[model samples]
Target: MIQTIAFYLFAGLMILSGVLTIMARNPVHSVLWLILAFFNAAGLMVLVGAEFLAMLLVVVYVGAVAVLFLFVVMMLDIDFASMRAGFMKNFPLGIAIALVLLAELVLGIGAYRAGALALGTPDGSAAPIVGVSNIQSLGALLYGPYIFLFEMAGVILLVAMVGAIVLTHREQKSVRGHQNIQKQVRRNPDEAVVMKQPTIGKGIEL
Candidate 1:
């Protein structure tokens, strides 16, 4: 009964927050609603006994992705009125794409339900002869079977990070960077320091 109640509560909150995420006019408020939806979804996952997925949702999605979204929304100078002007222009295209995606999701779920797609059972049937913990099992499969793909994904993410840095990076003309530190250290005291005298009543000129 407790599980059922928690499930319903989480589901309701998730749905409400998801709707608010899209409906909110302010980008920061929308991101906040999205974070709430993620939290409720994580709760529902935990209630369902998928603690691994629940942790992933909380640690990865809620902690990193949602926080990044919040930061980006807060930092960006977005003109919502200009954005809204383009919304109606793309409404039909967006609706059509959403419908297509909905149809694809329905078809995928139907196929899974009908046993057209055979998913491996969690009873260690299709899993390797190893541990039963979800983390261990996933690690084994990822390292043993999908190592190349995993490495490829890491490389892709690294490239993406570099590209993002390059795009956002700028050279500051006013900021001086340290250079030739070793040379400066090896220089004589005469090159490094100078003592000067000025009139007692007047300040030294630059």
Candidate 2:
């Protein structure tokens, strides 16, 4: 009974937060609502005995991704009106896509209620090495069986980070405040500072 109540509560919150995220006026507020949705979704995962998945949702989506989105929305000088300029123009296309998604969701739920479709049975080569905790079990599965795939995912993320940095970075010749690291490093103490000793009453001049 307690589990059912918790499940319903979290599910409702998840749905509500997701709606609010989309309908929010402020982009920052939308990100905050998205984070709330992530938390509620994580709670639902916890209720379903997927504690590791819940933790990953909280840590990755809520902690990092959502927070980063919020920061980006707040810091970036984006014209929200300009961004939403094509809303009316794209309204029909958006509506069609949304309807298609809703239809798919209904079909999926109906199919699930009838019977779950079997995805695939794991090959015996990658057998599970049971550990004390779910996290440990997951780590064993990821590092032992799917280590190469995991490493490749890391490399992909590294390349993506580099790509993002390169895309956003602009070299402006008009910006006079740029620092020259090599020039600063090559400077001597003599050029940086002039050793000048002035008397108590008289000042020393060139």
The model with the greatest lDDT is: 1
- Native-referenced Cα lDDT, model 2: 0.86
Q: Scored by CA lDDT, what does every candidate get?
A: 0.87, 0.86
> What's model 1's lDDT at 28?
92
Instruction: Give the CA lDDT, 0 to 100, for residue 155 in model 1.
Output: 100
lDDT of candidate 1 over 1-206, digit per residue (tens): 99989989999999999999988988899999999999999999888767789889999999999999999988989999987878878999999999999999999999999989998658753464454766677777888878999999999999999999999999966446657678778988755545458789885544
Prediction-by-prediction clash tally: 0, 0
Candidate 1: count the clashes.
0
Return the lDDT, model 2, position 163: 100
Model 1, TM vs. native: 0.69
What clash pairs does model 2 have?
none
